[model samples]
Target: MKGIRGRYGQMKVLETELDSTVKLLDTTIFNKDNFYNALGRQQDFIIRPLLGPQKIRVNPVNNSLYIIESTNNKQHFTNSEDVYEHLLKHEFTKKNYVIQTVPANNQSVLHYHRFTLHRISSSSNWKVVHHSITGGNELGKIRHALPFLKFNKVVRNAANLLGNYYLACNTIVIEILQNKMGETWITDTILHERNSKWSQFHSLYSCKALRSYIPHTELCTKESLGKFLQSLRQVVLKPCVGQQGKGIVKVTKLDDNTFEIHENKQIININDFAKLYDYIHNHYLSKNDYIVQQFIVIGKIDDRLFDVRVMSQLDETEWIITGVLVKVATKGFFISNRASQLLTLEEALIWSNSKISFDKCVSLINEICGKASVVLEKNCKGITIIGFDIAIDSNGALWIIEGNYAPSTAMFYKFKYNEMYETIYKYINKNKKRFSPHSD
Candidate 1:
């Protein structure tokens, strides 16, 4: 009876081995060029060809698999043990292969591991595939994803609390900049201080301050605001909830009975001040929060407006300049530096050399940026990179236009590719050092 049981077990093992062999043979045959030639133009068969040859052997005793493949007509044996060891060292354990077809009948194959691949159909034929890959473990994920999440939530809350578009923009800018810049430089930082109530809590140079140049302003009623506007010969009315140089009206009192309102290049006469006020009140004013900021004429070049955007990063003790872009206003546009017509800083400097000394401008920029770094470390939580937009007047006085927390590195790649790569490599290395366990 015992001999019969042992024979049964042996038979079971033999059957398993035979099944594996059949599977390998089938895969090899399906992968052969002759098989494809015979199958001809079958779409399914063409698309689902076996990936590789099946001249492979599995050793259950040693938990290893071996594959024989020809490269340059020379056969090579690859052991699964070696392949797996290499993959493990490189952190490629969780892997996935995806094949997708687009509207233009184009196919894309993606291989990913330890990351999420999200595919969304945009239209009948158009599709967008997003691959978010993260190295390291749960702690790494938390460190990387949290800042952006917090930023989104903070923006949403600011938008809700501030009814005026300008006020909301101010709030978001100040919060982010202050966090990056810190609290000290914020106190006397002057950009445009509007509505002192909001300004009190969010002072320029402080983590709460939005526009850097403005002084602390008081929140005033519409009637008070109208009186203030009347006092000034010229004033700029900006919609609190606007961006990209939109909905800005520059009003200049001409004489006793007339006023000039400028929108872009077009100028119109304002005979009825009350009507103008009503227009602004209904369109720009909000229940949340808004500011009537004092405007200053920014420097111009060749009868056009332009601003310099300096990309910067802190490397240990040094503040490194990554790249600089000059935003030139389009023809008939009053404000330059809109997203549409952005040029490198070099281009802008060459074009507007007569207006300002490029070398001096850069020197001043670097100096101020160094100060900005000090502000960032003190106020902001975990910001490593900062993009500062500075507007230099004809007098060469630098004004803080705005600050971007997550600036794109595409512009940097154009001219400073090596610098950009080095920065990235350093950042990755720093992260590795921080996360990797130290050995005794």
Candidate 2:
């Protein structure tokens, strides 16, 4: 996060309006226990925009709200029930999490931040765009950023965290920059397609070349659930827009009346279809939109299932797979990111017990990943890197699970893939995309 704090450049800080829909929760109740809170565009800090000056704490029990002041005593209670279980199930997830050893009295609260410049300048840190844009975070933004953007990449690169990144469209910035300043900027990130799982699936499904690799995914409704389970026999139900393996449920149709739902490595079998549907509706799909997809019998290594994480970057013309890691789910857990393990592609494939040849397996993974990236990029221009989660089935078939726009390299580093980690950022270090002016 140091890199983002030390940002440079003469700029102006901008305050975006808060949406009426987002709850500006009282975060005082958030102690070291409540580590999963997000800066939902309601508060700010001059010194550090995301140190969260006013943390709204919501009482999970009564849903009572308290602002930061009342939470000073640090008197907080962690949800002792399903919260831990839920977190444990996602233990094997991607780099969004961290494992640290510190005294209970003191723990570091760090987050992954991204600072964007003219075209595409991003790091785990922040940078100065023009003014306090990310200021009192002023110094931080310069330190991590301008140096990289200003200096030559052949010499060095740095990593820092200023704050977390959210998917807020730049319609406001675009309007003023164009009509007022006669300056224009292209979208340097994923637009509409990646937000909804169904939308992303449909876009890729529309492409004939990629259609085969996509699982039969449909919006999960009462009708769709019954139809999908009946037709696909076994399927996976997940939130329409989410990352990692959070809230993913695997369902298997054992017989006409019996059904199995695998979650958090535990299987709950229900005999009645209506009851099973109710259980799922109340638990996994609670008031949120979900998709039921035909479950591919993903291959297993010993008792655990594994998938591929391909970090693909854009070349001047096409996308290239820059980094590869295998995400092996915790044993018996259908959700791959829960308590997962990381392995090299070859290592996982070797232990995967698939009859497929290693060479052929690697080739298929690369092929599927490449094609998926092409399809995703075609939908949105200015996309430079894609972190693709690809799955391999029992028959050695490759499936495109999903792609992440802002991929993390912490996994590569934590797994001691130093060489690979450095290589991936080196491409990003340059921030190859430059400001191209579009004037009226």
**Residue 308 shift from truth in candidate 2, angstroms:** 0.8
Count the clashes in each prediction: 30, 37
Best model per lDDT: 2
Which regions of candidate 1 fall more than 4 Å away from where they truly are? 1-234, 237-249, 260-268, 317-319, 337-341, 344-347, 353-355, 408-440
Q: Write the per-residue lDDT of candidate 1 for residues 295-361, one digit (tens) a residue.
A: 4556655667777777777676566776676766766665663434566655666666535677877
Best by TM-score: 2
Candidate 2, which ten residues in sequence have the lowest lDDT sum? 170-179
- State, as a TM-score between 0 and 1, how close model 2 is to the true structure: 0.55
Instruction: Estimate TM-scores for all models.
Output: 0.44, 0.55
lDDT, candidate 2, at 15: 15
